[model samples]
Target: MGDRATLFPVKHVIALDVGGTGMKAALVRADGTLLHEDRRATGRERGPEAVVAGILDFADELRVLGERRFGEPALAAGVGVPGVIDEARGVAVFAANLGWRDVPLRALLSARLAGVPVALGHDVRTGGLAEGRIGAGQGTDRFLYLALGTGIAGAIGVGGRIDPGAHGSAGEIGHVVVRPGGPPCGCGQSGCLERLASASAVGQSWATACGDPSADAAACARAVEAGDPRARAVWAEAVAALADGLVTGITLLDPRMLIIGGGLAEAGDTLFTPLRAAVSERITFQHLPDIVPAALGDTAGCLGAGLLAWDLLSTEVSA
Candidate 1:
């Protein structure tokens, strides 16, 4: 007869960050180390149901991969998704980009994963949690995480928790009006902060100024570094608008730090140097929060998802 096999248990969790265009997933150990990672297209164009299927399939694949490598299945799963989320009910309430509406994602994932506990969260908020607990905001009691990608969004972290507010839409700083009669926004608001300061907005502004429709935000930054006056003007405008919005946030929340991430932040000092000066110029009474770039980059959301899964496991054990 064959020798008796040793039963060694491996502890790990599945974490997923589902965005409009793609999803990032990982098998994370209990100590926050990643065992494996992968990315998959969200296939949102095929519709919300299809996108849900894609997420589940990708998660299952990660679970199988983890089992194959570690000799055990994941203990739980956590998912971070864009748009408004009903975390209590584990539903993705609305995601305009993904065409999601009231989808019971957590329940579906739990069923798909054979009853593994699942936690669901808003993507930006989850990323903020990671930033606060392990990344740039580490040791800070309060901080604001602003993502300036295709559009602007924020996450408010306080005392190690992300405040989602009563409506689960606490940090929609992108909609805060900065220019009363400026460019229109998809949210039906004119002169919104996102319209003025988001990476897409900056790119459009530079493109229009330079008469090159294809110019992007990175190109604009390069042009500025190359001493292009038009690029400098465009970059300054965005910095001014961003500072205005950030000052407003500081006035209200009084966070200890403001962490900026997303595509616009790739400009590095080109964005931060002017942004600090602009914000300093505006502040009068409120304490100036340290404005810093996000340390985790694109990995924040995935790490935050891992945190959520681990938290859920803890909760289940305590219960």
Candidate 2:
């Protein structure tokens, strides 16, 4: 390691993206370069309190690392977590996947980081912010970021900002019922888009069909690529449901683009080709936005968190 001291201070911020099982963090410079990056398991199995503590511990470690490397503490910090968030209060309202509820994440992080300002955001929306600002939707004024992961979610982006609706759940396109009498969703709705279209759903469907309970969406995509008829049928169903749900979003938002991300999107053309055709066929009066894959992959969340921290500092300075 280099010397722990430096002659001049380098401006940077700490960024953390917390998922159900993992956390990605970075020390980001003002010009968007990731000066340092790290990852760790969320230790969710240890329970929600432990998860929060782990985040705090991780942030502390990053802070110490940054001070050691750059000779300055992070000016501010930002974190993105999965769940229903009360952004105004910086509270994690509910996160079924992480077993979190009403966690004062911003305050906790700020206190842990010796009062460094903290900005907290929802994970998918935060990722969408990065996608719209610097990734696939870059240069587009309006776009919809759809992540087809373990669950499906949408982030409505406009003018380089994510619209966190009135109740803080604006772009929940996944819960939009596409097939009224279809499979049940964890969100307490039957036939929701995620139930039929998410990566997890696709994998479960494929597993049932192929008689392999351990199979996943990537395996299903591989099978489809190999011309497996059963896999093709399964892929087609998920695409159709996704298209239907997207059409509904298009009808409402009329975004300039649709940026698809998450594990299913890893299939590339296997997911996009038929998806585009199906969406085109279903849309009658709605304009079909250009569909593209997410450019940042898994790093979007951490980048977005950095942006969030930068934005917070900007706001503070402006005020």
TM-score of each: 0.96, 0.98
Number of clashes in model 2? 0
Q: Candidate 1: where are CA atoms >4 Å away?
A: 1-8
Q: Which candidate is the best by TM-score?
A: 2
Candidate models: Cα lDDT each: 0.92, 0.94
In candidate 2, what residue range of length 10 has the lowest lDDT sum? 1-10
Off by over 4 Å in 2: 1-7
Candidate RMSDs in order: 3.1, 1.1
Top-scoring candidate (lDDT): 2
Cα lDDT tens digits for candidate 1, 176-226: 999998898888989999999999999999999999999999999999999
User: Model 1 Cα displacement at 102 (Å)?
Assistant: 1.1
Q: Which residue pairs in candidate 1 collide?
A: none
